[model samples]
Target: GEYEVLGEIGRGAMGVVYRARPVGTNLVVALKRVEASGLEGTEAVRRFREEVENASGLRHPHIVPIYHVGEQDGRPFYTMALIGGGSLEQKLGQYQADPRAAVTLLAKVARAVHYAHQRRLLHRDLKPGNILLDEAGEPQVADFGLATKLDPGGAAAGGPMAGSLPWMAPEAVRRDATLTTAVDVWALGVILYELLTGRRPFGGKDRSEMRTGILQAELIPPRVVNPRVSRDLDAICRRCLESDPDKRYESASALALDLERWLRDEPVRARNTGRLERLVKWTRRRPATASGLTFLALLLVAGIVAAVTMANEQDARLRQEVCRGNEFAARHVASTVLAQLQHFGEAVEGTAASTKLTEACDGGDWPAVEELLKARLLDTPPGPGAPPFATAFVLDPEGIIRAECPQRHRVVGGDFRDRDYFRGARARADRPEGERVHLSRVFTSKNDGLDKLAVSVPFRLKSGGPVWVLGATVPTDATLGVGGLHDKARKAFSVLLAPRESDGEEYVILVHPGYESREPSVPFPAGRLRPTETGFAADDDYADPVAARHPDYRGRWLAGFAPVPGTDLVVLVQQPYDEAVAPYRAFFRKFLEWLVAAAVVGALLVAGLWLSRSGHGARV
Candidate 1:
């Protein structure tokens, strides 16, 4: 042997495969020799060579890479990266009952198939035997012998379509059917079914019977066979196995992404078909039969209406409980925030009134003023684990920072004349003397680049002149203050919103877990939370299509809001609406399922009784 054949891997319709060590190289490769009896002709060899050239162009981690093509003793052969773990066929037993494992494996393979399709090539024969696993147990598609190079219109060129009958698409079973990329999708669905349920979806004793089954058989959904298979996975499998090629996924990529979505626990397109949509599709397929079942369905619908009324009542109760719970949480959080803000205010006010600070400022002893500020605000107080204030600084009459605690030398001479805090403190004379401490709008601190709320208090070395502002900064993200109040509210998350002074936006989100930086408020989605005379209330409307269709809609949320008692800030708590009404929704779905089943049985009984009476009358 020119190459040392370590062992025979397998024999297939295209060639005999061997695990071989190439001559004069340390590399081990899987070599296939084109020794199939009828494929020895020159044209056949050329086509094989062309197919290998095309397969070689595919470079994907999940697709076997062809290394070399050669011929020896008038037999063509090609070598590819040797996958040592064996074919997926041999490993099917391991993932028999594990749908996630099967989906994880198939998603990669589906993506590789899609990659081939993008380059106008079709892997017409995608079966478990053709999917090889490497040492790491990653699937790599192999054996593209029946692969077709599609034309520009995406149709396979003329040839006798060859595929394993068991894995062939229904359209492929018919001689007149046009071949397309959907055949590959159908094969993947079969492999996925086998992986999930340990048996193929369509099977029979002979090829003829199997073809019939493939064309006409009602598929026992993957979930029905393996209770462990989820509805999403079952739907995905069914979508791929649609007998009508047009009904199948548009491309292998679509199938792959749906499977990946399922793996990520996100919404999948396959499972988005609502029950009514499924019913409509079924009725459209059999109009006459649907007409016969209409009366029975109406009776079922009447029952469904009654059940929905009861469910709505139960849901209303749940919604009330959830809303009240959210309101309580919001109030508690608001109170906590108010107390913290008041404490911060008192600290700023007391520092502003200090006689020692006034003496230092009057004498132009800036270092003494900085020390006093640091002692009062920068040093950790007895109760807090860390200092509550991020920074404390004194500004001159011109709003220039004269001195700062934990001083940044660069910020010492920096002017903040345009800042809201500076402007608000300078105008404090317009308000009553007791309201001199002003809470500025949330602003990003220049010193630390974190969102900070400034509590600014104005004081004078002499009465009513040269008012210098004393300001303390508190971080919005700190656990000891504003953002942490919702820590105990497990069912809901909190947002702190500050009333905006500018135009075009309602509020500026001071703190939100969802946003990376500050953002202007968008309209509160309709039917989610609305203002009532007493307080906030959630509407019972379930068909808010805007929220349902918007990609960014986190989910439907029932919200409660409370204003911080002395400030314009609002603490809003939102809980997922679905979770709050989950019990009622689940019970309703089960009820509809049973009602539909019972309706079918009842309809059949009524028809049988009517027929028996008619036959007796005819005999008389």
Candidate 2:
């Protein structure tokens, strides 16, 4: 023997693989030997040779590389890279709990399969058992014994239908059906489904039942089986399991691409987006300012593809990109708004919780509390990091404005019991001392006659006295406040929507694009400026990009929403869909015109050559 057989690693249908070291070398390798039963005839020997040939032809980081081939005692054997981490089948438990890891591993495997496909080789028996993982958990495709070169039609031409039964495609089960790369995709889908849901998409008692299941059983969506599975992942898995070969991903590469998109938090081609999820995904992706550069790069790539695809389809792709861009922008702005709101809320909470302010309120010192509020207000200067609050005030247990910053003496004794800010703070008095602050609904100030939003916290004055509320108000139209949603282009802007008090209640827009220009005299009702799809369900639908016309805004828009944590405020970023996509559409139109002109020129040249040939024949 030319090698020292360390031990038998595993056995399969046709042969056994062993851990061995070549004779005169310290290197370890996997040496596979054909069993006596497998080497019974010339056909078996040829199959053994073919496996080595097929595996050797593939050169990829994720594919097992063949090292040597030989025979011993009339039994053929071949040596290849020794993978110590074992097969994917042995390590399936890790993926059971983490669908993302499963997807990532499968994506790499799918790429290896795609590599083989590009070389006209088909891995007819792709399964977890055949996928070897290295020590670092990187997947390396192995066992290409069933691999066959693709015929002229890009399908397996002849030979008996062979593949792992459980992971086979419906077409593969039908012996006479043409087999393409789709069978491998079907297996990849099965692997993904099992990883996501911890169970196979189709199961049965026996081979016949399994075939029947593959051919006819309805695939339970991955999300339905495992509630934790995301909608995007479910869609990707379902697309791979589609019974119709044409409906499945056209190639293994396409399947891998969809998986990559899911990992990147981008909209996958497995399903149409432009739904609420797209916006939600953008938050996780943390869309950066480089989105424009990303779009430009995508545009360059698309221009190259424009040559093969129809101009109309190219135009659609461009629009899709723009829609995504709008979603990204909206998500970015929403995050900024949420951070700012959280900063303000923290400041208000911190000031109210201070020992000095607490001592002033804990005693019968309304004047002292008023002075403390004024000093605290000045501490946070009116600059970039300043709180948006224009005035800070203290109210007695009777809801009387006891004292206020900048000393509005005329309103010091005014009662504000009916005000939402006062009521909101009082309502939360039963809560823990640290958690007693409340963000009130939008309302107009009685004294200033201007729209105001308030954050109020409840505290007790003198252990014997009833609880008092300390509050701060930000004018709705303040330049640096939520109401100041200034979008210079008017194409896109951010709006702050106050959450509904109860189910089925309308969501009021506390801030809007034109809030600065609105008349101060006209009273704005709480429900007057409601926007559609502002409910909790719509805000939570995070698997699709939200692109539709907002009824209140009166135009089709691509929007993204983010909820301000620990508060009832929601930030909505809306971009007019048409305006966002216009530039891309114009570029596509120019590309289409060039394509048409080139076609016309080529046609004219052909016609001219034909006429000259006819005239030359007449002269002869």
Candidate 3:
């Protein structure tokens, strides 16, 4: 027959197997050829012939049948049904074993070994590598050269010792020079252990370590390595690896019976220790892998996002609190100023002598009224002059300054007709018995000085006609504390008061403390003041430059067009972003440290388990 030889299917210690197609049927078949070098002498040749004869007699479906055994081209050769699906070892490595699939495949292998045993043939090597998977993925045990015929003195010279050392039974390792089905049972247990845990039971760094460990050390519980393995499955694996052959299943059939029972949900004969059983249950409950860690990381990220959202909410609330506090203070100061103005109006109205201007207007005759005004209507300690009035003045219906305190820089003759404060007061005065003390909107003073707030009240004569306007001035600085001029972090803040124009534009009127003189100063037009988005005109009223930039200026500052309680003025407070959230920053850093630490600990645990298993495999 014209058979085309393809490639080698697999190689073993004794021979090589090749895939080939027969010419007659064009069907694939595996050919096993014993190397001539391996059959060195007459004794080796005789041993090869014996193995061939033994393999040719096996006819089970799970056992690879030897179709022909002959001498081809001066080399001993044999042909069998070629397994299209390759070896069991390859499948095990490629696909992680599902418990059901593992049990099914294992049961098939056990059945094959049992059939061989019943036929008086013991397969000394029964490992995954020797178990071939056909095109249908069914297990077919091959490489029966190491098979012991179970007849006294019929086993080959090197047969028992020829199998894989790691899969060898304890009796085989000790060179007990015996042939028994128990050896096959031990190999089956090792294969089951490897399938469940992805590793060998007993192994360490070197061959010596593996040999010694396998003989002395206890196997790592399968559930410890693979939590998916059931306690009953683990018990089955441990029993097969028992040192004493007497303790092992009597035969492959008996082993298969127990495996079938386990598959059927029936309890096997094997006993499970309390801790080992608990570990198996735990593994089934939650696999000890990075998947859990991955889930935890996702939860942690979600928590962090939630925490950040809450922090932002808290930050907004704190900002509102601070703003509300400043507004309350501004209203309190304005109310105090309004009350003083009302008192001043009553005193002037009550005294007819004071209402009429005497020809000689000397300081001593008006001392009592002057003293009264200075004492009640001025800031305490009043510097070193008559007094620093708490309100700025605008006069009569024409809107001009009549009298001012701190007599050193008298503004009595100054005209303020174009100012918003004067116009607003004049309009109020026109009303019949209108508001006696009219509060004005916030505006910049034409006087090239720091920003000041003005308060005006009409003086009604005995004849029922308006006489003059009495008022007072309060500097922006005195109303808002020096600390309030800077941010909470102590960063410097700038203020500018500009007049609003009819064209909707505003022009700079006064730079507080003359811009250049303030500490930690801000830049401004040095030459002549010009109109700008930030600039205010003399007749317009607005908040300081810093306050104007605020989105909540109308609601928070309580100054400007809206009159604050006690007085009419706006107050602004600015702080640096870093200083505003310093506490939160510190908290975030601590949280980050804890998160990193947790990740490190989790990674270390995973790495340690991985390395330990790798080391165990290396020894095996």
Candidate 4:
């Protein structure tokens, strides 16, 4: 509260950093807001607090010290000592021309990083901008925002990707291994190289190109770019930029030691590889040799490419036929089941509403309505494969349970005014006279612990505005089994009944063979019936990967949906992308293996031919 408002110093995804001064004190400080107000959450706040604690614990002269950590308006904020001198990024051109000063600055930053590592703190992001100079022109490490602790056993971090993309290590970019302190070491190498050459080692115009360069581009030696660079300094810079973390300096301390040696004109530990090591490293280091091998491999497989192309065409044709057949079957099945349920409900509504029972229902006289229902309506059979109707009931305008058929449970006087079906039917009362029976969203019964939906119709007193809702609770499986939609033929596909959530715009799984509520499951049961991508909000992004594939499967998928007439629900059908691409992927994998074998054979033949010719020349 004592700090006065000041200009913003930096802004990032997490929050903003500002340069502020205390009301009565001469000292200035940097204020970091953990996250903006709109982004507040329990998890986000917890992570913010944890990061602040991690940064506050470091006590090195080159490391910035946190003065205070506090929260305002549900957002956490921390303050640290403000460095007066500009960041290392601002001094790149100045340092690039002075080799001694560049190495000296890098050595100080490296020593600070090593100090943090000793405390198990890994500063995942180590670009030049994060290193700032104090008032006396001394380097001080700042911004531990992306920092994480290193594993004692040195296992890689399995967390989300950290750090700027251009300076990221290959392992961090690929996300194939756990992150370790080695990532920071790799970033420092990049910083040192950038400072020495006035540009990034793997420079590109955009992030995608930068990522490709980092993963595949070879290092351009500093001495070649700037001839004034000494061999010792060049070797030190290259050692830090080694693509493999293991090949780079083992620790920040070791990098500092080498930089110090280069400054003092002493022989550095880093050097060019011997002949045998160079021969082994030739394929990796020499892009030309690798490119030639790749060219020969492609030539050797040219003949087989035609065969693979034909196989792919055949695969596409087969997939199209399969999809057409599956859709026809699912549509026929879904329509059949929905028709039967509507027909049954329509019959009951016709007979009961026309009789004197209307008066009893309108008056909320449940006992009278029960008698009228038994005397008039015939009991629907527990069909050969169908689930028995769980509930046949009527609700008054106030949504109280007035009558229950089959009267198994004493629910005649209970309240159902808060139920989804009653609410849905009432909402439709303003619609044209023709459309009114509203099917509720599927939900778990609070009492019975089962998933079910209510098909409800609103009726009036042959007259007035008071609406009575006739409801029936039907199990989801009953709708799915309408025409054998989940039969043996559909083993490769998934067909489900989905409904929009009443409380939100997101879609929720109502019924499917893969659903836990779907008993006597299907052949290829999905791991999760609930879709991470299913929703129908106004501004939903259709291209989102989650919305593009079935949660149970990976890769692209083919999905189609048909609305259930008279209701805001749909029959959703989904099948694996592999169903269409499996044949292609399979054929290609085998073809690739064969091609690789041919390429290796061609390489050996060329090597033998070269050796034989050289021996003959030597003999001459």
Candidate 5:
């Protein structure tokens, strides 16, 4: 380095820039010394010489002209004009305050870049530090440290990797983009953005992030950061920073014209830009925002899946619970109804008056039959809380009501052939002695006008000479007494008792909570009401019951069965689907609300953490 070093003017990762003079010449110069020992070997020396030649190739008033190049003591040094006004980096505060003046300076710098492009020179490292201002305050594009010669045919400029990472055009960084004047134009755009906004477009915390930002990050327009920057300048800056090299200005000369237009208050060449183009530039400049949005979108999707799965699982669990509760309830109801039937059957057998009553009715002694019915049949009170019997009548073999005991209303000669109770007793007339009484299939009683069950037994005047049927009708609802079991706090349920056979072979409604709540006064029309199933008494163990559909309710109900002992009767407890699954719906709704709140909080926490960590390492 054959120069008298005056003082350190600046220092960078490469080496130190100093104010110096040649051994023989008294001319003041800015000297950059490439310490080969640190740079290591022939490649560093070659690159050092290239930097000098690249600057010397083109001569222009606004371009820092290289005056000398040489090597001494294993070191390489180059000399250019001593820009007393310092780098554009230091002048940013002053120029950013007056955007018009800043644009004027950048326009001149752009022309200097165009001059180098004319000579097939590409100054790929164009940044604020690379641009200098002379004593007269005229901008001079400097630092050809990473410059390359554009191919004469405008093909790619392939050489050693070079350029300021943040300011380098994406194609130049890749070293595959065509080595054309557009590369210099892109660098000029970065310089102008820094000069006007007092900030760089890329704010990545590391070289890797910087490279990505340059390649794909959005550019924050000059006007956005600094309102003093006009829309024309904003558009001009974007045109140059285009990710596609082809989309950039054809040459630095073209960029200079657009910037000049802004200074002249005329519309810029980048006027064709639209919202989409601006948005792309903004996205590129803010990589963190894009990545954060992508991360939250994924979290949102995952949360939705989790909520749906949780709701389904909860629904399943609630249904199982409802089924278990209904199982216990069904057995309780079945036992109660069975007990009432057994009690009445025993009373009839123990009373000798019942046999006398049957004899009197068969002998056509109407007066004695009436007295025997009152003394033997109606005297056995149905006990406390038991469903009262509608009537006790003796049906002769011809199926006529002979005598009604303590009975009101009318004719003792009423025909009983069509009645369910009479038919049921007659059917079981030849039943074995052990299987004494017959339990009638459930039916709506025409007398009391409620759900009723007929339990009957047969007797002979003289050892099967002629059979007579003795029967009683009991209201099934009062006998079962299960309406209150349909607890709101628990779950909705229905209870049914269907005798083996007797009435149309259809198991009938005994105590349905759904029905009672719906039509308390209006009786279910007999034989018109459809049964949930047949052969309920044959079921041996708990199984999935058939779903019963009723238009009186919201949805279908699932039934669970329990058979009563020593009887052809099955008790069923049922529940609607919605009621069974209500708990699940409530739980999932709360969980979803909490999940959404947590997701939003998590997103904010991550974003804040990133900002806190990145504040110190922001690219200058």
Candidate 6:
């Protein structure tokens, strides 16, 4: 029997939703029906089934539940729970004049959308219209019929569906349909903008115009539209709506965390606008006076000088610091590689002992030797514990793998003799030098497919020949501890590891924690290293002469380089310049302020004395 279709509840480009009750149960639900005539028959059926299957799998409280799917009179239909309240679009219109209520409501919707994203589903059609409010005013995200699973392989070919264009991310509009969680982030930014400013960030009369605006137009800052919104909030919104997907928050969780942090009065994760914004904010808050103007001018001049000086000092310090950090990380990673090699060596030695016995009993069993080698090669290492390094790969002296801890099929017989680490170790071994570990200059790995630090230690065979050079490869990302180095000191400070090239040229290889925000100065060569700057040079007694002439720079930063134990690399640590120099900046500001006050007072006294003298003369 054909299922009965009830009154229409909502309609859109893809389908129409209706109020319906299933047979025998009398259970009321909202049924969505897609017109088969409007789309390709098999493709439409597949899409409908996929949507139903995907939507049914989601079990979050914020997401609307999909109940059942079937055909009624040759048309596809899916039923979902009938959410009782109006859509968020209606709520927005109802509360158009109230910014606080709108922001609060949109934040709730963001949370729901974020929940869906956590499950790897993107509500590609995330607009106020798609979000429905329940009786208790909780947002329930509906109409996932247009949602797409974030499968990198199954990305759609065309531009995002037209209905969702207003809330679509710029990349989505550009039809770069990788459709990451960043799309959701962009939509949330639009919602936030609309909520605060009482209007869509980019609006036009038609879809084409809207798409054009979204793809090309810059977002008007929330503060520009609504003066009451704080600069911090504006910054957050701008970050979310950044045209470049890479610049946007990586995920909805990151966005939600930032928003929650902002609400809780915690420091937000966003870019700082630096002294320009600070100066503007200061000027806006102050009264205009002759002394005040002079003070402001002096302050600006001093700040520019300080920033330039800091940049120079930072350039040198950053290289040293990155070198030190990478060197530290390299040593740890090298140790891990060394341990794996030592284990492999033991395995090889054991196999050799067994093979000798087998050979003595059976006239030199070559097949048995081959089988033993294969078995030892195929043996997997134990689970890597929480080591300081990210990854460990091993290579023998000929740059061939005897065994690698993180076993990969590609590196087993691969030749690495041309690699710097291999060449350096072999050269050292040719000198009949004692088995020593040589840390290769930090360079991006050409064979391992990542930026890596290579540590090579030569192993001598029983015949006094360099049999194998054990090379350990540690990926730079892993060594730097991606996103795991956040600390109070890191927040106000920076650390870097710089390595010197063969000709004594230093350059930055690694910067830990918050390198993106501070934009630390490190003089890495554009393509190749320059002479006179061999990686980072450590001077425990290093002092900036320019800073020495200016007391403000005294004790602003303490820097020292220590050789990464067991490696030629150096680790440099720089204390927080802001914290170290806060006292000085504050003192200088106060001193200048008092000096201006004193000068003003002295001028007034002189003027009074002259006036009194003139009055005495007139009386005479």
Best by lDDT: 1
Report RMSD (Å) for each prediction in the order shown.
Answer: 14.2, 25.1, 33.0, 15.1, 33.5, 15.3
How would you encode candidate 5's per-residue C-alpha lDDT over 1-620 as one tens digit per residue? 47899888877655678889887978888888775466546665677777777777668999888888766676778788888887788778887788788888888888888787778777778888877877778988877777777677755555555677777777777777356777778878887788788778887888888888887777777888988777777888888889887899888788888888877777678985477788788769767866786688788789889889877787666666666667667777667767766766655544423566656766788778767656655665554445445566677778877766656546367776766666766676677763667776665544545556666777777775666777765553522432354545655454555642334445555555544321222222223223344323221122222213444454455555666766656666666666666666787778888878877887888778778768867863
Tens digit of per-residue lDDT, candidate 3, span 1-620:
34677887767656777888666676777877776575545555666676888788888888888887667666677788777787878777543458777778888889889888877787777788888888888988987777767764333233335667778787777677665788888899989888887788887687677778768887787888888888888888888999888888887777888788888998777754467678677667546454556566786787678768877787766555544443344344335433444544343222212433221122223334334445445544223222244443325445655444434345556776776556655556545443555544444444444444455555543445655555554443322222233332344232333233222233332223223222221222322233234221111122334333334322222121112234322222233344445677788778867866776787778767767877898999
TM-score, model 1 to reference: 0.46
TM-score of each: 0.46, 0.45, 0.42, 0.48, 0.43, 0.42
How would you encode candidate 1's per-residue C-alpha lDDT over 1-620 as one tens digit per residue? 56888899888655788989978978889888876565556666766776687798999999999988888877888888998898999889899767788899999999999999999998888898889999999999987777888888877853464778899988777753468888899999999999999999999999889989998999999899999888888899999999888898989999999999999999799877477888999989756556657878788889989998998788878877876877778888888777777777788888888999999988889899999988888785413343457788888899899888878886788998877788899889446666898888766667765566688988888876877898987654423444455543355667676643332234555555544332222333323335667555643333222233234436577667777887767777767787677767888999889998999897787667767867898999
Q: Ten consecutive residues with minimal summed lDDT in candidate 4?
A: 535-544
True-structure lDDT of candidate 4: 0.70
Model 1 misses residue 611 by how many Å?
10
Displacement of residue 482 (Cα, Å) in model 5 is 8.3
Determine which window of 10 residues in candidate 1 has minimal summed lDDT.
Answer: 517-526
lDDT score at residue 418, model 1, on the 0-100 scale: 79
Q: How do these models rank on TM-score, best leading?
A: 4, 1, 2, 5, 6, 3
As a whole number from 0 to 100, the lDDT of residue 65 in candidate 6 is 85
Model 2 residue pairs with clashes: 274-545, 275-544, 275-545, 277-542, 277-543, 277-544, 278-544, 278-545, 362-462
lDDT of each: 0.78, 0.73, 0.59, 0.70, 0.68, 0.59
Candidate 3 accuracy as TM-score = 0.42
Question: What would the per-residue lDDT of candidate 4 be over residues 531-568, giving only the tens digit for each residue?
Answer: 33422111111111233233654445445445555555
Model 1, which residues run further than 4 Å from truth?
1-294, 309-321, 381-387, 429-434, 478-484, 487-490, 500-506, 512-553, 603-620
Tens digits of per-residue lDDT for model 6 on 1-620? Answer: 43466788877656778888776677778988775465546666666666787688777777888877777667778888888898877766555456546556656666777777666677777888878888988778777766777665423333545337788887777777466777778888887787677789999999889988998887789889889777777888899899887899887767767777667666778746476788777767543443455565575567657755765586556545544553354344434444533443343334333534234223434344334444433343312332233233444445665444444455556676666777776676644333354556655543454445555655454346444554544333312432323235443222344464433455554444333322322444323321124343433333322232335334544443334334444444444445544555676567556656765675566556656867898999
Poorly placed runs, candidate 4 (over 4 Å): 1-295, 301-329, 347-384, 404-420, 423-436, 441-451, 460-466, 501-504, 516-557, 584-586, 593-620
Give the Å shift of residue 289 in candidate 2.
25
Residue-level lDDT for 187 in candidate 5:
76
Residue pairs with backbone overlap in model 5? 217-284, 217-285, 218-281, 218-283, 218-284, 218-285, 219-281, 219-285
Q: Which ten residues in a row are the worst by lDDT in model 2? A: 537-546
